[model samples]
Target: MLTENVHIAVPTAFSEDESLHIQGTIDHIRSLYEQGVKSVLVSGTTGEQHSLNLQEKMELINGLEQEEELMDNMEIIFGVSSIRQKEAEELAERIRPTKLAGIMLGYPPYVRPTQEEALIYSEKIIQLSNKPAILYNNPNRTGFDLSAESIIQISKIDLVVGIKDAGSKEKVEHIKSDTHRNDLHFYAGGEEELEEKVLHGYDRLSSIAGNISPAKISQWFEKMLKQQKVTTQESEEIEAIMGQVYQGNAIVNVKKILNQQGIPMGICRSPIGNV
Candidate 1:
């Protein structure tokens, strides 16, 4: 079971010429590990997974395998999705033998596979990877919404532990009420309207801001989860952090901050930072 209440969806670092900077990516992850982040989601939307080809994705997995300490300690959840199901399967097979803790299985964007097709895609990847899985539903980006019924059905799979950005309060409530499993986690992606999402039944977090301030974000999220009070000072601090992160392109801003701190995060793959 994936036990962490929160995990940072880290960005993939790239050099000036837009080549993958595998070491830079690992370096940032190691820094987060040092700062007490227990989990991270690599190659997710924030990591620009869709922008990377299969070869690049495989190279990242290889790079991560080299970091023995990070692999052993952190719950590193990899993101697996490709327009081509065959490629996704190949990646799943590749991850099957690694020390990776889990996978965040996202639907292929643009293609917009039907719910039945989507279910099959989800099942095949989960079975092949043989890792705990988090179903990621981002219709805004993917243009395919995994319906509440589909989510309930997928939750029956022993390998699927949670769902991220799983639609509205009604959908989440419906899935929770109907699913046989009680431990199904609803993960709120990023810090946007997080309190509302929590009230509506989002029990876990896929944190983007945590990349910059892991301890602080974790503290706030825990307090929110437990219904604990936040001091005025903490509220202001969190607001500032949120503004710094959420005001614009969060990934670009985060990379810039890390770079400014001398972490060598470099620039985001072009077109991302082009604006």
Candidate 2:
């Protein structure tokens, strides 16, 4: 069971030519580990995961496996989603033997499957991966919303631990009320409108801004979870952080900051930083 309340959704480092920088990605993860970050999600939406081919993702998993200390120390969750179900299944099988802690299972993009089809996809991947799973619902990107009823049914599976960006407040409430399990976590995708999301029952965080300041983001999110008030100075500091991150193209900003700090995060794939 994955138990971290907040996990950094770290971006995948690419070289100057936009090839996967496996070592650079690991280097960033190592830096985060040293900075007291306890958990991380790799190849997530922030990682430009869809841009990565199956072979590239497999290579990344291979690279991650070499870092025994990092894997042992951090709760590493990998994103597993592809436009093709067969690829997803193959990826799940690939992840089954690794030391990765869990998977963030996202819906197929563009080609929206019916709820029943999505359910089958979810179940098959979960069973194959044999690890804890977090259902990722990003209808804006995937063009398929995993309905609250579908989520409620999926939660019955012990391996289905949580849901990320599970739609509006009312939908979250509906799912929460319908489900009997208390361990089902609701993870806000990023820090955007997080206070409101927390107020609406989001207990966990899949944090994008944490890539730049893991400790600070974790501290802020913990306070938010507790509904504690932020002092004026704290608010100013947080506002500054948000300004730096959320101003434009968050992943691009993250890479720029990391590269400036000499972490070799490199550039995002084409069109992401084309501006």
Q: Which ten residues in a row are the worst by lDDT in model 2?
A: 41-50
Q: Taking the tens digit of each residue's C-alpha lDDT, what string does model 1 give over 115-142?
A: 8999999999999999999999999888
TM-score versus the correct structure, for each prediction: 0.99, 0.99
Pairs with steric clashes in candidate 1: none
Worst 10 residues of 1 by lDDT: 262-271
Q: On a 0 to 1 TM-score scale, where does candidate 1 land against the true structure?
A: 0.99
lDDT of 2 at 158: 96
lDDT of 2 at 220: 89
Clashes of 1: 0
TM-score of 2: 0.99
Cα-based lDDT at residue 43, candidate 1: 96
Report the lDDT tens digits of candidate 2 across residue range 1-275: 99999999999999999999999999999999999998999997784889999999999999999999999999999999999999999999999999999999998989999999999999999999999999999998889999999999999999999999998989999999999889999999999999999999999999988989888889989999888887888888888899989999999999999999999999999988999
